[model samples]
Target: MRKLLGACSLDVFARVDPLELIAPAPQGAALALYVNLLAESLHAAGRTARAQANGNSYGETVGELALGLAFELGARQGDWDAFCTALAAEHARAPAFWRQAGGEALLRKKVNDMFAVLRDKVDADNYQVACGRPCSPNRLYAYRMLDTAYGEIARLFAGWREHTAQVGAILGRPVDFSVPIEVRQLQSVAACRPEWIMRWSESLERFGGAPGPLHTKSKRFESLKNSPDKIADMLREIAEYEAISSNRDSGWLHDQDTAGAWIEDYWRVLDESAHGATPGPDLILEARTEELDAPMVEVAQAAPVADDDPLDAVRAQAVSLPPGFLSAARATQDPGSWAGRMLEDDSLPVRLAVYLKLLGAEDDCYPDAWRDPSTGALPNMQQLAALDAVSLPTLRKRRDAAIARLEAAPRTGG
Candidate 1:
C-alpha cells in the first residue's frame, strides 16, 4: 500500500488548492499532499543532517522532523483521522500507474513543486501570527532571496584571498594579500552591513555572470533596491530570531529538567502550612522603604470605623472580613508614599486587587485585617470585583491600568 501511494504521481493529487486542502474534500487530495510533503521533507532533512556532520543519525533526524511536521499540520487542520482515511482511498486509485517505472522520482519532484507553493501559504500565516501584521507568500519569497544573497556574500567574504576583486567591490575598497579585518570580524549575519549587501548585489553580475536578487529584472525586490534602511531592518530581524532560536536549542535539556520542578516546591509549601510548621501569617518582616532625597511628608491616619457599619455586616455574613477591616487596612497606608499617591484615586477594593495581582494573595507584607478570615489571605479577584460593584473584566482593566501607572512612575533611591 505504501509503495502504491509512493508510485502515484503528485499531479493527480495537486489539483486541489491550498485553501480547500485545510477543509475536507471529496477527492482526498489534501491527505496525499500532506503525506508526500512529510516524506520528502524528512528525506531532505536527513541528507542535510548527514552533510553537516552534526552527529545525528538519519533515522533520528527524520523521526524528529516527522513529529514536528505532524504537530504543525494537526494544529492547522485539527483532524488526523481524515488524513488516514484519505491515505487508504489514495492507495486504491490507478493501480496500473502505481507499477510504472521511474514513478517514485517523478512523484518526489511533483510533491516538491506542490509544497514549494504551499509552504508560502503556511509561512505567510505564521508570519502574521508572529508579527501581528499581514504578509504575502511573495514577501516570504523575497525574504528567502535576501537570505540567499547574504549567504553568498558571506561565502565571498570568507575566501577573500581567492575572490579579492569581488570582496573589494563589496567592501568598496581594494583588497591586498594580507588578511582583511572585516573577514575576521564577520562572525554572524547581524554584522553584515547594508552597504556591503547593496554593493554585493550590484557586483554579482560582474563576478558571477548572474544578476543579484535586488539587481534582477524581476520586480519582486524592486522596492528594496534603493532602500538600504529597509534591507538593514530585515537583516537585523533575521539575525535576532536566529540568535533566539539558537539559545532555545542550547538550553533545551536544562529547560526539560526544570519544567516541572516548580510543582514539587508548591506541594512542599502546602504540606508545611497544613502541619503548622510555618510561622503565623502576621509574623511578617518590616516593610523596606527607600529613603528619597526629598523631605517626607506626614500623612494623617484614617479615622476608625464604627462597629455597626453596613459593610462590616455584609462582610461578616458573606466573606468574613475582620472587624474594622477597612479602617485598619487604610490606617497602614502612607498617602505620601509613591504607590499610595499613584493609586489614591482608585477605590479600596481596586487598590487591593492591584496588590493581589502584583503580589500574590498570601504575601507576608499584607496585614492580618486585610485578609479574609476563612482564607487568611487577600480576597480573590472575583471577590474584590464584587466588593467594587464591578465586573471581573472591569476590575482587571483597572488593576492593569494601576500597575502600569506604578511601573511608569520614576523611582527615587535604590
Candidate 2:
C-alpha cells in the first residue's frame, strides 16, 4: 500500500471533508480502517492504480461514493452505456412509484429523489449487513441509515401507524397486529406455513385489496403455503437474473455470494464469538509497531546487551560447527519444505528472515533482542545482530541475499 501511494499518504486524503450526502457523524477511525483494508485487498488483487486512486480517504472511499451515486441515478447492471440509456429513459417520464398518505405526492417525490443518491452510495452487500434484511429498489427510498431494524422495528411500526391511512389503503382497511395473519406475511426463515397462506386467502376475500390483480383467484397462492425459506432459496437461485433485467441492471448491485454467506454465517459468528475456533499457536513473534518506520535494510547499531549473553556464545559456536552439519540440515530442507529449510539455515540473516517470513516484518524479535518476549520463538533480531558482530542493515542484506539465493537455487535431491 505504501509503494502504491508513494506519491501521497492516506493522511492527506483522509483529512478532506466528504460530500454532504453521507450522515452517520463522519466516521474517523472506522472510515480510515475500512479504507486501509480496502486498499490492501485491492492491491492484493493486483489493482494497483485503482487501490491507489482512492488514496487514504477517511470517510467513504470513492468506490462507496460511486456505487451510491449510481444507485441514486437508477444505475443497474449492464454495459455502462446501455445502463445509462435505461436510466435516462426512466428518469423523468414516470410518476413517483409510491405516495405518502397525508402528505402531497411531491413530498414523496422529493424523498425518493434524495434516496436515490443514498442508494447509489451504499454498497449493496454492506447495506444488507447493516440492515439485517434485504434491500429492494422499491424499499430503498424508505431506508434510514441511523435506524437499525432489530431495535428500530418500533420506529418502523410507528411510521406505519402515522401513515395508517396509507397502510389502510394497501390492506384495504385500517390494520394492526390483531388485524389478522393474512394481511402481513409472518416471516419465517426456512419455510412458509401453509396455514398462514390459507388464513391470508380467507382474509383477502373479506378485506379486499387495491384495484389491480388482488381480486383475481389463483392456485398460485397455494404454492406460497409451502414455506418462505424455500421461496427465499428459489429467489436466491434466480437472484442472478437481475443481469437479464434491463439495459442498466447491475445484478444484485453487490457481491451476492458474499452477502448470502454473511447472512447465513451471522448466527455462526454470534455463536462462535465466545469460542468455536481454537486459538492460534502462540507465534511468540510478530513485527513491531515500528516496522512501517523501520527499514528493510538493516542498521549496524543496537542497544547494548550483557557480555555474558549465552546467545553471544552460541553464535560464535554456530559459525564454527562442522560444515557437514550445515549441509546435512540443507539436504533435508526442500523448497516444498521451505519452512523446514528456514529452520535449518545456518546464516543468521537467512534464519532471521525465515523468522520474519514465518511471523512478519513487524516481528518483536528484531527491534529488541533475539529473545521474543511475546512468544520466545527465537532470539530477537537485536540479540542476533549483537552475536553476529554485524550491523542490523548488514544482517538484513545478508539475510535477503541468502533468501534470494535459496529461492533461485535449483531443486536438490530430497
Candidate 3:
C-alpha cells in the first residue's frame, strides 16, 4: 500500500496533503506551503528516512531555500505585484499589503536581503547538476511553480467538454463543446505547447479581465513563451523528481550521499588548504570536433550601422545589446509596442531565448555598466537551461535555432 502511494506525482501528493490551497496564491505563498506539504508527503511515501538521513539538523532547509528563492525571483523580475494580485483574484482573497503602492519597494528590499543569506547556504553547483543545469535555488523555485502550473493546465485539459468556457479561454478562441476536443487542442499538458498558456493569458482579458501566468510582465515566464518542448521537459523533470524522491532506494538518494561526502572532503578544506585544486589539464579537457577542421563561413556586414531597423526598437526592449540600448528602452516604457516584434520571429521560443541571452546577467564577462541595472547580463548555458525550465542540451538547441533565424534575416544597404 505504501509502495503504491509513492508512485504518485507531486501534484498527486498535493491532494493527500491538506496544506496546499485549492486555489493559487502568490508564488511565494503557494511554493512555501507546497514544500511543507512535500516534506510531509515524503513521510507518507515512506521516504522520510532519506530526507532526514543527514544529521545536520537542516530540517526542511532545502525546501525553505527553494521558497525564498521564488519570492526573490519575483521581486527581481518586477513580477511580484502583478502575480500576487492575479493569484489573489483567483483565490478571491484580498491582495496583500505588499501589493499596494509604496509596498513593492519595501518588499523588494526584504526579498533581496533574504536571498543574500540563502544564496550563501545553497551549493548552487550541486543543485544545478542534480536538478538540471542553470540550477540556482531561484531556478529550482521556478521549476516547481511551472510544474504546478502544468498540473493545473493538465487538470483543465482532462474535462475540456465539461468546461468549454475555460477550454475556450485556454484555446484563445470560442469552442464547440458538441464536437470532440481536437487532438491538438486537449492533449496532455506535457504535450501542450507553451503558446497555449500565453494565448490563454492574452484571451483572458475579455473573459477575466486579467492576464494568464505566462502573459504577465514577469521574466519568470519569459523563457516559456512558445516553447512546447521546454514545457514538456520541465513537466517530465518534476515527475522524475517525485518518483525518485518517494523511493528511498532510488539512485537520487545515493547521489545525495555522494554529494554530502564530497562536501566534507573538498568543500570544507578549500580555504584552509595551501593549494586549492581546480579543474585543469587532467580533469577537464576540450572536445575535438570535425567542425574544427571545416572552413569557417564568412559573412560581411553590408548594412549601414547608423540606420536602425524598425525591428531594432523591439530588440532594444527585449534585449540588452553590447552597443548601448538603454536609451531606446528608456525612451519607450510601453512593452506592447515592442512585444509584437516577437511575433515577427518564426519561433517564439528562439526569440525569447535570444532575448534571455542578450538581456540576462553574465559572470566575469561584461562591465557592470553595460548590464541591466535591475537584472544583469545573460546567464551562462546551465543558468539559461534553468531559466527556460529545461535541461542544458534543450536550451542549446533552442538558442542555436534562434541564432540561425538571426543569421538568416536579410541585411539591407549593402
Index of the highest-lDDT prediction: 1
Task: Give per-residue lDDT, candidate 1, residue 274.
Answer: 45
Give a tens-digit lDDT track for model 3, residues 1-414.
Answer: 112212222333336332233354564665444333432343343343432243222233232223223322322323334433443453354344344575444434433443443442243433443455566665566565665566656665666677678767766678784654543464444455565655555655665687766667888767776676776677666566555333412235435534433322332132123234343433221212111111111223222232143223222222223223433222322223222232244333333345444333333323343334456653334333333333333444556555444434322210
**TM accuracy, model 2:** 0.22
lDDT of 1 by residue, 46-163 (tens): 3343322322222223233232233234234424444433434444463323235764464454344443544455556555544546779888787766777788888998888899
- The candidate 2 region of ten consecutive residues with least summed lDDT is 142-151
For model 3, where is the 10-residue window of minimal lDDT? 287-296
TM-score of 3: 0.30
Instruction: Please give each candidate's TM-score.
Output: 0.46, 0.22, 0.30
Whole-model lDDT values for every prediction: 0.55, 0.34, 0.41
Off by over 4 Å in 1: 1-110, 121-136, 249-259, 264-414
